[model samples]
Target chain A: MHCLNVELGERSYPIIIGSQLLGDAQHLLPYIRGKQVCVVTNETVAPLYLSRVLEALSEFDKVDTIELPDGEAFKTLDTVNRIFDLLLERRHNRSTTLIALGGGVVGDMTGFAAACYQRGVDFVQIPTTLLAQVDSSVGGKTGVNHPLGKNMIGAFYQPRVVIADMDTLATLPEREFSAGIAEVIKYGLICDEPFFCWLEDNISRLMARDPQALAYAVDRSCRDKAAVVAEDERESGRRAILNFGHTFGHAIEAVQGYGNWLHGEAVAAGMVMAAELSHLRGSIEAGLVERVRALLEAARLPTAAPQGMTTEAFLDAMAVDKKVMDGRLRLVLLRALGDAQIIDDTPRELIEQALQTCGAT
Target chain B: MHCLNVELGERSYPIIIGSQLLGDAQHLLPYIRGKQVCVVTNETVAPLYLSRVLEALSEFDKVDTIELPDGEAFKTLDTVNRIFDLLLERRHNRSTTLIALGGGVVGDMTGFAAACYQRGVDFVQIPTTLLAQVDSSVGGKTGVNHPLGKNMIGAFYQPRVVIADMDTLATLPEREFSAGIAEVIKYGLICDEPFFCWLEDNISRLMARDPQALAYAVDRSCRDKAAVVAEDERESGRRAILNFGHTFGHAIEAVQGYGNWLHGEAVAAGMVMAAELSHLRGSIEAGLVERVRALLEAARLPTAAPQGMTTEAFLDAMAVDKKVMDGRLRLVLLRALGDAQIIDDTPRELIEQALQTCGAT
Candidate 1:
């Protein structure tokens, strides 16, 4: 087992990574400070892993579970309110700890539920998907989507601990598994050059579900992410670098409709567009863009925008993105592989051209 | 204008108290970090002061207004969602500052909206009611009520500045004005004995709308509340003392229906019950309870629980309050005329007796 601590003072917590760690009371017990526990999972994940967590928490004075419908479309304030309803009905207090037990959607909604439940409560993340374990679970960016944009309503609430069991990946669909790799690739492109080279060397072993390789990727991704988040928990300045492909990716998700494309799939295509724009800005060589595409292709992730997605649609969606400041779109473009910078002065024509290059009509 | 700062590190902000401060661009603009502004006021307040604020903000690049329906019944996640919808529809970006231009309901909903809108943006409080001016607007306890409890869904988000205009109080209905005085009296009873004495002497002057007396009361209440809040920003320890009377008050509000009795009116009655509980616990003399009742009576606030309210209803409602931890009901009771403490071990029988003493059947 490997444990990495996100260095947010007082709010700091550990991310525990290993195989079959779900049923272990030791990893889950110390972090739950309250006598009551509520496990929030989804229909798909509940059938697989809910009972293990419930059994683990059986010693608590009170234990409850709510299995929500599974999918990105269910990630809304209304869905989160159901958690609140169940909590209030069952009389969960301020000291109660909420355990999120599914993929990113479940983690996002449950973490948000914890954030707003009784004006904040302790929560633990048992991320069941690679997309969640590597990216969403670690950063403390918990929220729900609005009809107009993704993650438009939420909070930067940290969990008491994150338990990432590699065994859960065995149940993840092939497409979702590849989606997680998109974020894993992102850590390399944004800040860690050696990890990028390592990914290039180890992509096959990771795709083949090699436990050792998968654990290393998750650990390295969390370590890299923890370092950036430690410096800026609220995404004030340097933290904006973490949104490298998210601006374009959120646009894709918004235009394509959430759940139509997996978040990681949109990000895979968005990263390609970002890399192509980096080449257009003469910040990086065209070879790096091709390298990003090749790596994503090897992972079975989408390398371009969805079919029939137009540049106009991208522009409209991106306009309402949280990254836009003072009417200027802040795009995180790669200055070079392993280094990204947020630039607000990018010409619209350049952005449209990059979208065109990435197969946006 | 009298300005008091709530000294929360990095989250600290100034509360400006005076007559006619709302329409002053100088007071509003310095705290606003961006060019775009959205004023969230209810229908009642918009017709009174929203236009003055809008006119003052006319110089900004973009200005928008959203007038929600008035009253506590409308303070819900559904109502807050309307603000989110308008923000997205108007393309209000991360840099837009939300100005809450009404009483506590509008301030809380707007502050909470600002807290969750794109995971937080800047907001300023234009508190038009004395309840907001002295208590809610200054403390940074922003949230909407849940069906089960008051203030069950919210955040501890501070505004860039709080603008408390005393001039608006002249137009306030007499009942609502007395309700605000309930909190003003609370500051004196909980932590400021000298101020409590001053209120006893000036109660009639304050009720008569003497500008001097009102300003002094607002300033004193803010200072008292600010000192306590600074020591415990998240209500972890000593801050719970600031919730003196809220446990019983929330019960009354929940059982009687939210908008039936004003928040301060409910609190006024609850304070008497807490005072009686304090007396019953042998913490204070019976004279203090009578004094509290007399002051509330002078303020034209309720001195006991509403007629026909039953002790069982109070117990059922109070059991679900956010103050409850691990099934133990934590009650804040007066230790003396100017001091308070949180006691969670209060016997259920004594609580029922206190409720009965306060006219609960």
Candidate 2:
């Protein structure tokens, strides 16, 4: 078991990563602020792990559950409203803690639910997939996708505690596993060159589901993410670097529709475009961009935007991204491998050229 | 103009109280985060003050407006969703600022919209009605009402600045004027015995809309509410005391259905019931309870609960209140004319008797 703390002063919380921790009351108990709690999960995960969580929290005075449909398409205000309805119907109050018991979509919606529920409530993240365990579950960015943009509506609400149970990842689909690897690669591409090399050497071991390798990668990703979050919880400054590929990735998700491409896959392609832009700006060597593409390909992730996507569409979608400031597009571009910077002064033609190279007609 | 600061570190903002400040561009310019700004108002207020606010912000790069139906009945998630849709459709990014130009309903919904739009955005409060000027616009309590409870969905998002124009209050209806006085009197009943006495002596002057009396009341009310909010931003401790009559009042609004009785009217009756409970609990003298009722009646506010409201319905509604902790109802009850405390252990029969005395059938 590995426990890492996201040092945020009074708002700080611990992330516990281990096998078979889902049914362990010791870890989940301390975070429960009151006797009343509700576990929010998706239909896909509820039948698999809901009872385990319910049994773990059986000693609580009152326990309820809300099961939402599985998929990014279901992440909406309407879904969040349903969670609010369940909590209100059960007479849950500010003291009642909410446990998010699934992947990123479930965690995002539940954390958002907790953030807006009676102003805010304590919520525990029990992420059940590789994609969530290594990324979204670590940062406090909880929100839903809008018809116009992905994650266009949300909050920066931290969780009381995050329990990343490795056992649950054993059931993740093959494509989902690869998607999680994209984010794992991102932490390296953004800040840790050595970790990137480590991934390069051990990609197959990770693909084979080597427990030690997966644990190390998840821990490293969280530590990298935690450090960034601690400095800028609200993404007002340095935190923007963590979104190295999200700008283009979100556009793909928004243009192609949210559920069409998994978030990590979209991010994988986004990182390639960012790498291309970095090369065009003379910020990185062309060989590094090739290595970035090779890595995503090795991980079975998309290395380009969907073929039909146009540079104009990408530009339009990117304009509405959360990163835009005062009508200027602020992007996280690599200054060098293992180093990222938020740059808004890059020429528009350079970005357009990068998009063209990445199959954005 | 009298300027009072709500001392919330970094998020601290000034409450500017005076007459005829609506079209003052100088006051509104500094708070605009970006060139893009959206003004959210209501039908009733839009026809009255929208043009003035728009004229004030005409220099912004892009300006848009959303006019919701006037009244507390429209303070729902649906209305907030409409605001979100407009912002998204217009490509309003995080840099865009939102200006709420109306009474409490518009301000509360607009503030909530700002809090949830792209996670959060900047918003300024241009409160037109006395009720909003004194209460909702100051504390950053932004949210929409739910079927189960009032303010069941929202956030504690502070605004950039609050522009409370006394001129708008001149156009306020007599019923709305009376409703505003209920909150003004709350400041006195909760923590200011002297203010309570002053209100008693000057009730008729305020009722007649004397500018000096109105300004003093608005400034004092904001100061009192601001101090409490600064001490406890999320209503954890001292802030709950600020909700002196709100537990019962919110139940009144929820049971009678929100727009049926103005928030201040329900709060007026709720204050009367709280006084009755305080008397039965031996915390205050019967004479004090009579004074509370007498003062509300002087303001043309209802001093009794609605005709058909039952103690059971209030209990049912109050159970879902944000103030409830772990299924226990924690209510802010008056200890004396100038003192209030959040007490959860008060006898249920005493509360039921208090409800009965307040016209609960």
Candidate 3:
């Protein structure tokens, strides 16, 4: 078991990463402020782990469950309203605690619901997927995607605690596991060269779902993400770095239609486009771009934006991304491997060049 | 002009209560951080003042207006989403500032939109109605209502500045002007005997729309609310006192359907019921109950819950109120005419009697 603190002062919470931790209720009790507990999960995860979580929470005075339809397509305000309906129907109050017990989509929706329910309520995250455990669940960035844009509406609501049970990942699909690696690789390129190199060396073991390697990767990614989030909880300045390829990545997800490419796959490809832009700008060596592509390709993730998405479409979608500062197309580009910075001065033609090169014929 | 601070530490904001201050864009310039501005207002308020506000914001690099349908019925998540759609469509970013230019419904939806847009953005409240200028616009409470409950979804996001222009209240309907007084009178009932006496002495003048009397009432009410909010921003303790009559009041609003009875009208009746409950508990003299009824009646506000609402219905609705603690229906009851305390041990029979007597057949 590994416990990492996000260090956000009064809002600081622990991220617990371990195998076979689903049944560990003792560690979760402190975060549950009220007797009433509502666990929100997706259909896919509920069948696999609902009973185990319910059994773990059996000691609570009251426990309930609401299972949402699985997948990124369901991550919308309407779905969030369903969670609110169940909570209100059950007469849940500010004191009630909501448990988000699925991957990123469930976690984001539940956290947002908790943030808005009765103004705000206590909620804990039980991330079941590698993508969530390493990336989304740690930071207090909880929101739902809009039809027009990915994660267009959300709140920076921190959870009371995050319990990432690695055992749940054993049931995750192979493609989803690879998508999670896209975010895992992000930490390496953005700030951690050593971890990036380690990922390159251990890509096959991670691909094989080696438990020890997964644990190490999850722990490292969380530490790095948590550090960035702690420094800038609201993404005012330093936190924008965390969305390294997300400007392009979110555009990809929105353009290709959410749930088609998967968040990690889109980010995997988005990272390549950003790295290529950096190389073109003379900030990084071409070898670094190849390495990033090589790593994503090894994980079976997309290395380029989807076909039929023109440069104009990418530009249009990217303009709506949250990272577009002061109406300018600001993006996170690598100064070098393991180093990223937000740049808004990139020429429009260069952006078009990168978009055209990355898009399919 | 009366300048009052809500005293929420760094989140504390100023409430500027004055006559004809809406056109003075200098006072609004500092709160607006971004070059882009989106002013959210309701249909009722737009034709009357939107042009003036637009004129005030003419200096911004870009300014947009979204006028929503008016009334409490429109205060839903769906209506709030319309604001989000406009923001996303317009490419409003994190630095963008949103200004809410209307009564409670518009203020609330706009505030919630600002709270969720790019996680959050700065917003200024240009409260038009008497109800909003005195009550909802002061503290940083922002949210939309759900089908099950009033303000079931919301956030405690403070505004950058609140511009409560008395000039706007001139166009308010007589009922809304009286409704705003309900919250103003509450200040005296909960904590200030002098203010209660002042309201009694000046109710007619306030009803007549005497600018000075309105100014004094709005200033005093804001001062009382700001002090309480500063002490307990999240309502864990002292802040709950502000909802003294709201426990009964919100139930009335929900049962009768939102907008049927203005928020303050329901609260007026609920305050009377609460006073009756206090009388039954021997927490206060019988004269206090009569005084509350008399004040509400003098303001021409309802002193009884709407017809057809049974005790069971009220209990069920109140049970879902945000104030319900540990599954118990905790209530804010008067210890004296000018003092209130939260009591959970009030007998069920007394509560039933209060509801039965105050609710019409």
Number of the top-ranking candidate, with lDDT as the measure: 1
Which pairs of residues collide in candidate 1? Answer: none
Error of 3 at B197 (Å): 1.7
- Each prediction's interface RMSD? 0.7, 1.1, 0.9
Which runs of model 2 end up more than 4 angstroms from their true locations? none
The Cα error of candidate 2 at residue B297, in Å, is 0.9
Clashing pairs in 2: none
Per-residue lDDT for B229-335 in model 3, tens only? 77888878988888888999998898889999999998999899899999899899988889899989999999997878788888878888888888788888999
lDDT of 1 by residue, A1-361 (tens): 9998999999999999999798889999999998999999989999899888887887999899999999999999999999999999999999999999999999999999999987899999999999999997677999999998899999999999999999999989999999999999999999999999999999999999999999999999999999999998999899998888888899899988899899999999999999999899999999999999999999999989889999999998899988888889999999888999999999999999999999999
Q: Which is the better candidate, 1 or 3, if ranked by TM-score?
A: 1
Q: RMSDs, each prediction?
A: 0.9, 1.1, 1.4
Which lDDT tens digits does candidate 2 get at residues A168-256?
Answer: 88888999999999999999999899999999999999998888899899999999999888888888899899899999998898899
Tens-digit lDDT track of model 1 for B247-345: 889888999999999999999999999999999999999999999999999999998889999999999998888888788899999989999988999
DockQ values per model: 0.88, 0.82, 0.84
Model 3 per-residue lDDT tens digits across residues A1-361: 9998889999999988888788778778888978899999988888888898898898877788999999999999999999999988888778889999999999999999999998999999999999999987777989998877788788989998999887888888988999999999999999999999999999999998889999999999999998788888877887788888788888888888898988988888889999989988999998989999999999999998797878888888888788877878888999988889989899998988887778733
